[model samples]
Each structure stands twice: as C-alpha cells, then as structure tokens.
Target: MLRKGLILAAFGLAFVAGPAFASAGPKEPRQASWSFEGPFGKFDQAQVQRGYKVYREVCAACHSMSLLSFRNLGQKSGPFYDDKYPNPNDNPYVKSIAKDYQVNDIDSETGDVVQRTATSADTFPSPFANEAAARASNGGALPPDLSVMIKARPQGAQYVYSILTGYQAPPAGLEVPPNQYYNPYMPGDVSAFYKGKGHVPVGGFIAMAPPLEADKVTFDDGTKSTLDQQAKDVVAFLAWASEPKQTERKQFGVAAMIYLLIFAGLLWVSYRRIWRNVAH
Candidate 1:
C-alpha cells in the first residue's frame, strides 16, 4: 500500500513538473549583430555568394540537400528574387561562368555539373556525398541538409546564426561537463543540427567540429569579413530560401492581430452591458 501511494505521488509530481520543463523555450538562437528587424533586412547578394562558398569549401562534405534544385541557386527563390534568369530550359550561368568561377565540381569522365537539378529519384547531393566519406572528412561530425534547416528547428534562423558563430574554447581548468554542450554565445548542451543517426552532425550549442572560420572568405571590396557576418548572411539567405512567401505571411499576421484586438474590444463592451446591474 505504501509503495502504491509513493508511486502515485511520484507520478503526480512528474506530471506537475513536465509542463514547466517542456514550456521553457529553448535557449535563444545566436542573433547576428545586425542593425535591423525582420528577415528582409539581412539580404545581401555578396554575403550569400560568400556563404555559398563557405558551404561548398568547408561544410559541404557531409550534408546533403536532396530537396533543393540546383537551379534554385539563381532562381526566383534566391536573394535576387526580382529577376530570374531567362532560360529555365538551360542553365546559362553554369555553362558561361564555368571557366572563371569554379562554384561546383565537374565530373572528369562524364562531364557532370555537381549540384545540378532537383529530381524525384536523386537525393540532394551532399556537400560531401556519402556518410563514411563525410565522417572521414569532418572529424566525425556530419553536416546535414541546410535546405529545410531554417524551417525544421526552433527559431531556425537565429539558431543557424548562433551555431555558425558559436565556436569557442572552454576555460583552462574546466573539462566540459557531461551532457552539457558548449556554445560560445549559447549556454548548455545544444548541438547544432544532427544528421539522421544519433550523431551530432553539426550544430547545437557546442558542436565538436568547426565548419566556418572568421575571415576565411572575403568580399569583392577587399574587406575581410568575419564568420559572424558570413553566418548572418547565410541565415538570412536560408530564411528567405525556405519562405519566399514571408512578406505575405507577415502582412497577414498583422491583419489578423488587428482583427483580434478589435473583436476583443467589442466583446468587452458587450459583456459590460450584459451584466451591468447583475453584479452582486
């Protein structure tokens, strides 16, 4: 009888505590120190191009984005959504720019353009392509698809920005505590994003391997940009990448809020009259 009572009490306590823990919204994602609000403020073509280079050169070895089309790079979905390339039938930029810009890999034997075309049958090409290959390349961390990453995780854009710039060394005498991850800016054990397996592919607060480095890539104006800047641009790119319809959503959300506020005011006025003299 005593055991039963104890079990019931334990269950009750668990039930009571569950919500408090669950509702504690995860740590704030790293926000790039940009001087603006909303996703549109961070859009920059140069930044996106640099970020694409970073992803291709360093982070692409492990992650695969099966969903994104190669043409998505310069399509209406890109940062410059105002104008699309003329021929969807043929990739003009790819053929023309190959001599100057080696943005993608060209197959030596078959002459295939790397990272081209989004097809139903083919999984998105990995920044690396295979699991063993990526792990061997990334020191055991597997980077995952960035395509839907902004939408998949909580506070996705902020998180992406945070993780990209989250690298830091732990204090001299303190070994990292168990189950607690390290993030330069974020506190606790959140790895960036995980690949399919129980692996900490990349992301969370303290990922083991670092994908982006400060000043590794530069802008056209001869300024060496920091990793934080690159990360911010990429986050903005990804945010836009996922939601081309973000402007519409915001407009609708504002309209909805206004409608609800008006409705609530009307309800209050109606309730006041309905119970005017009935208050005891």
Candidate 2:
C-alpha cells in the first residue's frame, strides 16, 4: 500500500511539474506570407524597396549591413537596377543613394582621416566607431548585423515578422526584468520569473522593444503603412539581402533541369534505335 502511494505521489509531481516546463519554451513562430516562398517564386521588387525604407529609417539606427554596397542595389535583378546601366556603379539611383551617406577616407595628399560622401563602390560604414561603442550605446546588448540575418536564424523571415508584430502585455503573475520586453516569439525559459503554479509563460524576454509603429515611415509608393505591412516588408528585404541571387539561382536550376530532362529523353531514344534489332 505504501509503495503504491509513493508511486502515485511521483506521478502527481510529474503531472504538476510538466505544465510549468511545457510553457518554458517560446511559442511556435507565427507563419507569415512571403512572395518568394517556392523554388520558382520571385521577390516582389516593390516590397523589397519598401523594406529597405523600413531598415533605413528604423533598423539602420543600430544594425549595420557591411556586406552590401550601393552598387549592389543597381546590379542586374537588384532593388534599383536600371537596364540601361550594366555597370552598377554608373547607375544614377545607386549613385544618389551613396551620396546620401558619408564614409571615412584618408586624403591622398594629407594623412588625416576625413569623412567623404560615400560612393557606390564603397561598402557601408559602421554606425558605431567600434564594437565597444556599439555596446555602450545599446545598454550592453550589441545590435547584431542585419546582413544575412535571415540565413543565421531558423525560420528567420517569419521569426522577424512575428517579433515585430507579436509584442503584447506580459501575462499576469510573470515578472519581466527591467530593460526587457516579453515577446512570445523570442526563445527563453520563463519559469523563474513566472509566479503561477499553473503554466510558466509562453515566451522569452527581448531587449528590443516593439520597433514598428503605424505610419512610422511614409512609403514612397503609397502603400498603407500598417504595423503588419512594415513587418512583412522589412522581413522581405532582409530575406533578399540574405541572398540577392536566389531568384537567379532558381531560374538557373529550372533551366538546368529542363535541359537534363531533354538530354535524357534523347539518350533513351538513341539507345532504343541502336539496340532494337539486337534485343531478344
């Protein structure tokens, strides 16, 4: 009888503790629609442009995309590509964009560092002078580079979209630490901060507060700037920045597949014609 009672107590304890651990992980990321989902799908150029606007106006304040150059924005199938300009550096739009920002350079004649207007050939400059400066400005959290961020995280595009749009009031009985905001999409264990015996919490703490606001940026194309729209567009841009050649790669793959199929068919036909008379 005592053995049975002890067994029952163990099961009861497991049942009680299970709920707490169950909600310890972040909620599954919300699915977001993207234009470039399937192999043949292409990026929406307009959407990508809008996404750049979001990054320039908001994300650029912290994150740096050092991998990209203004010239890349005017390359073939790029965001601001103009067919007339095969050389991206010569593209007027790219030049204009580069002119808006300043880059550090040393004067050829004098050895002093000087800030000069960026050119299409120059890579992006870091927002902070150094890593330590970056950390100090952002409350000890170094803002990550946005370049290729989509590839770095699992379900990255959707993850970004959810985080931007998923901020909500923290659940009751959960104590969020100072300088942190709760986000259901962020991965973390919340049981320690959760006071309830029922379920711990469904999300983790994030250092970044909600970055998107309605009408935060006025779109040049006149798309209504909702919170959801901003999130979707910026995610799209990051996805593109992660792999600008994705569309071209997909196109090449399709063409290669077609060519291979035709070659295989011709080979089969040749084999039948050559061996038909000798076959039993």
Candidate 3:
C-alpha cells in the first residue's frame, strides 16, 4: 500500500508539472491538422500532388531534395503512383519529367564527364553546382535540403507550415538586423524580458525570404492556391517524403497490439486454470 501510495503521489506531481514543463519551451507552434496525422490517417493524394507542384516550381529553385529519386515519386505509396504505371522505370510520365533536367554523367565513347538528360533513376539534382555557389547566390545562407525536412524540424509538419506562413513585420521596438527577416515562427531572438538571462536564441534571421504567396502555383485540381493552402499542401507532401511507410507502420502496430492483448488474455486464463486447485 505504501509503495502504491508513493507511485500515486509521483504521478500526481507529474500531472501537476506537465503543463509547466510544456509552457517552458519557446512559443507554441501553430497547429495544423493533417490528413496523415492519427493512427488511421491516410495521405490526401490530391493535396500531395498539388504540394509537389509547389515544391517543383517555387521551392526547388533554392532548396535541393538530394535524397529523393524520380522513381520514388511513382512508388505505390507515393501520391503520383498509379497502377497503370506500376514500374516507375517504364512510366511514361516519369520519363518525361526526368528528361527536363540535365544530369552529370560519364560519356560512353569520349571517356569524359558530360551533362546528359536525367533519367527516372537519377536523383533530383541540386540547383547550384556546389555549396559555395549556392551560398554565393543566397547571401551566404545555405538552403536546407527538403528530403527529410518534415522529420528534421520539431513538431515536423506543423512547424514547417508555420514558418512558411509566419513572416510578418517585427513587433514594435524589436530591431531586426540587416539581411535578417522577422518571423515569429522561426527560432529567432527572444523578447525583452529574457534578454540577459541564460536563454539563448535558437533560430534567428532566416536568409530565405518568404517563399509562398497567394496563387503562387496553379493547381491542376482546381483548388484555390492561397498562401495557407500552399503551405498546408507542401508540408503534407514533405511529411510523406519523410516517412513514406507511416501508414504501413501504423497498420503493423495495430496488429501487434491485438496480438499482445490476445496473448496476455491466454496467459491469464492459463494461470487461473493452473492455480485453481491450489491455495495462495
């Protein structure tokens, strides 16, 4: 009884402190509901495709998705995947998309490196030749790759969506440094109250300007391309990119849970039967 009481006391204290600990972090990120959120959640294919369009037309100019390949885009789990094109390698649409980019390759006959039309097997190429060129073009700030961006950031998809839509005029009396844009969502300088305290700013002065705007990309599905809509869609796509197997993982988890419950029940029944003839 004493041990149980101590455990209950500890739990009570934890319950009381939970909100305090949660509030200690930097401002709470704006929450956005995603189709692929809960256990039974699934990706909205149309939104994913629209988001991909946004990434290709706008975000691709500065950011690189180095870890993704054209073939991955047509996998069964991908938004663009179609039963009609089961094999991404032979998919006509994938082939057409790959042909737009120039990839570096070794010449077959010349024995030298040359730029060739990209194939479905080729990974998405970087916009600039190297990091130096990328920095030079973007005023010394390196644009992060979007391959695992959803997984990389805290609060994942919601944080990204907030950052994309959070750009605004700095609050009164805050001096935003040159070349530094003000965004409440980006981990930047702290408020005046915590100036000299031990709290150091985590994220500040983002280099890339606001990338999304109203009607920035035309959606083939006829959805109005508002700023928030674009942010939501692209973040959804990034979430899928980061964890393509999320749905499968959840499905497996459900099965495992059911199995464990059944096993536990059987064990309990066997224990009761075996001890039925004996005394405690």
Candidate 4:
C-alpha cells in the first residue's frame, strides 16, 4: 500500500509538470457514455474489438500507436484476448494480425534492410520513417502518435471523441487558410479570425481534416456505421490502448481495499479485547 501510494505521489508530481496540466481546448469535450468509468467497471471486449477495427481501417494510415504491439491485442482483457492462449504471443488471432503487416527489418544472413512479415512481438510500425517525412506527407503537419494520448489530455476520452466528431463549416468570415481546417473542439486562439468583435468562435484551426464519416468502415459485428459510431468506437480503442493494464489495476485496487478492510477489522477487534480488562 505504501509503495503504491508513493508511486502515485510521484506520478502526481510528474503530472503537475506535464503539458496536460495547462491544456486548453477551445471547448470542453462533449461527454460520452463509457463502459469503464468506475471502480468496478470493466471494458466491453466486443466494443473494444469494434474500435480496433475502426482504428486499423481508418486511423492507422496516418496515426501510429508505436507503444503497442500486435501481441497486446491478445493480452488479458484486450481486443483479441483469448482464454485458451495464456500468452499473447501465442494467440492465433494476434499472429494473424501481425502477419498482415510488412515491417522493415535487417536480413540476418545478408546484412541488408528488407521488408519482412511482422510478428506478434513487433511494435506497431510508424506510417512514416521520420518526423520530417511525416510532416511533409501531411502538409507540414505531423500526425500525433495515439499511444497514451488518452492519458495526455484532460477528459481524455471525451476530448478525443469530440475532436473526431465536432468538425463543422468554418464560422462566417473566419478566413480559414489553405490546408487548415476549423474544429470547435481544437485547442488554440482563433481571435485572429474574429475581426468582427465576436467570441472568436469557440474553437481553433487544425491541420487535420475530418477523418470519420458514415459508412467509412464496415463493422464486422453488423453495427450501423454512423459518424458518431465511428468516432465513439475509435475513441474506445484509444482509451484501451492508452492503458492496457487499467482493468487489471482497477481489479487489484478493489482487492487491496478489501484486504485492508479485513485487516483493520481484525486489528480493531484485537485492540478492543486487549483494553476490555484494563481500566480507563
């Protein structure tokens, strides 16, 4: 307990220094329903799977989740988790997913760079080889990595959902520039676009165009593909990816609390017995 508390304290201190501390999205993220919200709440595996599908089909082309590997998809409570496969590396589903990706590797015998089929152990490869290339590909705007993005933002999940779904036509006379788009949820000062003395519009300029659309990616579960649905699903996957161990951590916390309660009760009973025969 002390160790966990210390770690949490250290984390809190670090967070105070983190960029997220000063986060200032133009508008508060629209709240959304989530399965993993409370202490005993758990992830909906089916929903996570659908979210992963959305990420793979749409987001993967531009964004990278390099902090995660294909094998993580098979970890306990993960999108492809299977009870029969105790180790994620052995999960057939994860293997199939990894096999589909072509990763850059060195040929051991020839000592040459080569494109090889990926394995479950490999991390998700970036779409671009370097930051410069990534920025160049997207009109000098680099796509941020999705790993830990949920933890890095305030109201993490809601913020991402709003950004994904909150795109709209630029407010009148905003004078949006080439390669830039306006989103009400994007964080930035748009006062420059407010020459007419209004509230500067409740948003900022973004390089990213609207990514999700209705029917963009078909869900295997036959769930209707609405713009809202796609945004929610992908956000869920990002939520899970942000902390793969969150469910396990919550479970451990519950067990620890229960144990502490039992121990405290026993100590109280012992103290009462010891003092019963003594005078005040």
Candidate 5:
C-alpha cells in the first residue's frame, strides 16, 4: 500500500511539473499558411514575383544567393519564368537582369582579368569579397548565405517570417547587451550569458538589424507594403528557392498513391476469386 501511494504521488508531481517544463523553451513560432503547403497547393506566381522584388531591393545587400544562377530567374518553376523565355539562356530579360551586376572575367586577347557585365550563366555575386570582409562589415557577425536558409532552419519559412517581424524592445526588467538587439524568436538570450551580472531577461537577440519596414519598397502590383505582407512574400520566395520542384513532386505522389490503391483493390478481388473453389 505504501509503494502504491508513493507511485501515485510521483505521478501527481510529474503531472504538475510537465506544463512548467514544457513552457521553458523559446516560444514556438506562429504558423502561417503558405500557398504551396498541401498536396494540391500551387505557388501564387504574383506573390513569388513580389517576394523576388523584396529580396532584390532589401535583403540582397547583406545576403548572397550564390547557389542560384541568373538563368534560374527565368526557370519554368521560378517566379519570373514565362512562356516567352522558354530558353532562359537566350531570354532578353534574363540577359538584362544579369547585366545589372559586373562579373570578373579574363579578357580573351590580353589574358588579363577584367570586370565585365554579367551574363545569364553567372551566379549572383557576394556583396563582400570574403568572410573576413563580411565579418568586418557586420561587426563580427558573419551574414549567412540565404540560398538554403529556409531549409536549414527548424520551422523554415515560418521561423524566418517570425524573425523578420518579431523584433521588440526588451521588457521593463530585462537588460539587453550592447550591439545585440532583442528578438524572442532568435536562439540564445542575455540572461543565459549574464548570470549574476545583472537582471537580463531570457530572450534571444540577433545582430542583423530589422531590415523590413512599411513602404520600404514600392510593389509593382500595388500590394500594401506592410511589414507582415513583405515578410510573407519574401518567405514564399525563399520556400520556392528551397524546393522549386515541390509542386511536381506532390503531383507524382498523388498519382502513385492512386495507382497503389487501385492495384491493391484488384489484388484483393483476384485472391478472393482464386480461393473461392478451395477451403481455407
């Protein structure tokens, strides 16, 4: 009877402590619906185009998308893809886009390296020459290459959207460190590092300042340039960049499932027919 009482008490204690423990971690990112979320979902082309604009006008200064080539902008699955530019290499718009940046190339006659207008074959260039330069520019925090950022994070697009919109002044009793801005969604907090130094509250901070603001970029489609709207558009574009073939893959999966279901039904019918004349 004593053992039973001890076990019951232990369980009661666990039941009481579970909620407290569960709430200890960083706040879970709020989930946002995506146009390309489910099996039947397809990306909204206009949103993707708007997202590309936001990336180009705002985020491009700090982030490099080295994995993507200029021609990728005209890909069939990409936001800027169009029937007119079936061959992205020869697309006039793609060529014009590439020309916006200067690329280093060796001169055919002189064999000397020279900066020239980029072509569709060229990948997007990094803003800084190297990691040292990047770190020097940003006060020791190296800006991450954004090519696969959405895939690299825990919640991908949702987490990014939260981070973009989550910046806030530290609460009344909390002390934020210099050069570090308060953002609850980012990992690591002032409290964790400042044990006994002061009354620093628990919430992560980031080095990159808030990049988005209202009316930062004029949308061609006339969509309101609210912070949330810009964040959503950019996240959608990043999602596409991470998995351009998502729609095709989902379509194939649906087709495969349908075929398997039909095949299974036929097999079951055949087995019953074949065993009809025999005893189990």
Candidate 6:
C-alpha cells in the first residue's frame, strides 16, 4: 500500500507510515519467485491445506477472516489457473467438515445489526464495524480480513509469500536509524507511522510479524521442513483464499480453448480451398 502526505506532516497521515510500520521486520519466510504462478513446486494442495491448518489452529484465534466461508475451502479461484481445484462435496479431505451457520448485516429501519443465516451461500461477514474499530481492537494493528487479502495486496501472491518467508535480518552493515522503521522488503523509513502510534508511512511496509514457522504444520507425508516450504504452502492457500471462483474460471477457460481450436481448423480449411484454384 502507498501513502501520501505533506513535506512536514511526517507520520500524521496513516498511509505514509502504514506500510513502513507494517513491515517493521523481515519476519516472513523466504520463497522463490515462481511460487506466484500455477503448479508451483512445493506449493501444492497439501501445502495449502497445511497452511489452512496453521491458520485454524494458531492464527485464527487472533485473526479472523469472517468473510471467508467454509465452502470456499473446496473451490479454486485466483490469478493463477491450475488443474487441482477445490471440490467441497466430493473431496474427502473437505467433505467430512461440517458446515456452520453464517451471519450477515441487514440495513433495516432498526439500523445496522447482525443476523445469523446459512453458511452454504457465497457471502461473508465483516469482522469489525469499520477500519477504525478493527485497528483499535487489534492493538492498533488492524488484522486485515484474509477473505480478499490475496486480491487487495498488489502482486498479492508474491507479497504474501514473501511476507510469510521474509523473517531474516538485513544484510551486513545495514542499520535502522532511530526514527525510521526497519523492514526487508520495504525500501526506507517512508512508513507513515514513525511516531509512537500511526499508520504505516511507507508504501510497501507492514508491521505484523511473520506468523508461520518452518515445519510448523507437517503433512501426513514426510516433506522437508523449511521456511521456504512453509512460504510456498501459505502463498498457495492465500491465492486460493483471494479468489474462490476457480471452478467457474476453469470451466470458461476450457470452453474458450475449444472455440479457439475450432476456429483455427476452420481457417486452415478455408485457406487450403482458396489457394487450391491458384495452384491448379
């Protein structure tokens, strides 16, 4: 996220300091650039499932993406397209999980309030009343709803992957000035929240330390336990989290592919017929 402000405003505007503070440290895991694409090596279905387990077991208590529905776990929707799509009903891994009641807000004459409903629908509930309230509740650190996080963050997959795996220290001789916030991915003190409390002044910085650890969530099959591996899994999960429309997109993609192939064949035949007479 980027921030704008006057020359002297410093950290008053949250945006300027938001990213810098958010990225105060390189606490995430390390990942390869290719993980952003589909069929990412080591970033497979199992890894995503494991990452989800980590979220549910460890992080969910503090952070909640109420907007996400259990049904979404079985679907695939994101920037990248892969053959392994989520199937809520058929997949044994997810089918056994019980669905729960979902709640939503209805704007009625009585004003804004929450109402519980079925969870089978595609909608989600907001975790907080608004941005300000959310930030206040979470120690001045708004735990962003993960439902659309993969989409909201620019180059979200890569960013999330980097964040997950970026917990290392800065290279030799790199010193964080007393006033400036420190981060690996963020370029400088540009974080808006330089003061005791404020938003991230830097554009690409965030303060929430990396949550996942190496081999934290081991799968049934033995796999190497490394931060990079964890990063791959978490990023895949986030990519799926961001887009729950994978099945629909894949269906459309197959149809488009067929149409293009048929069109190409027709063009080939037309060209042969048109040139046949000239050859004779």
**Predicted structure with the largest TM-score when compared to the true one:** 2
lDDT of 5 by residue, 91-125 (tens): 78788889899877898999998998999999988
Residue pairs with backbone overlap in model 4: none
| Top-down TM-score ranking | 2, 4, 5, 3, 6, 1
- Candidate 3, residue 161: Cα displacement in angstroms equals 0.7
Query: Using alpha carbons, what is the TM-score of model 2?
Result: 0.93
Over 35-118, each residue of candidate 4 has an lDDT whose tens digit, in order, gives 988898778898899999999999998999999989999999899999999999999999999999989999899999899999
- Give me the overall lDDT of model 1: 0.56
Runs in model 6 deviating more than 4 A are 1-43, 76-118, 122-133, 169-181, 187-205, 218-225, 247-255, 278-280
State the weakest 10-residue window (summed lDDT) of model 4: 16-25
Off by over 4 Å in 4: 1-25
lDDT of 2 by residue, 194-247 (tens): 886687788898888789999999999999999999999999989988888889
Model 1 C-alpha lDDT per residue in residues 168-241, reported as the tens digit of each score: 65433334544345554444432322212232222224434556677766655565777776677666666655
Worst ten-residue run, lDDT, model 3? Answer: 193-202
lDDT of 3: 0.82
Candidate 3 residues lying further than 4 Å off, grouped into runs, are 1-26, 108-111, 190-203, 266-280
- Badly placed stretches (over 4 Å) of model 1 are 1-27, 33-42, 80-91, 94-124, 176-181, 184-205, 221-223, 244-280
- lDDT per model vs. reference: 0.56, 0.89, 0.82, 0.89, 0.84, 0.56
Tell me the tens digit of each residue's lDDT in model 3 across 43-104. 88888898889999999999999888988778766778888988978887778888999988
Clashes of each: 14, 0, 2, 0, 0, 42
What TM value does model 5 have?
0.83
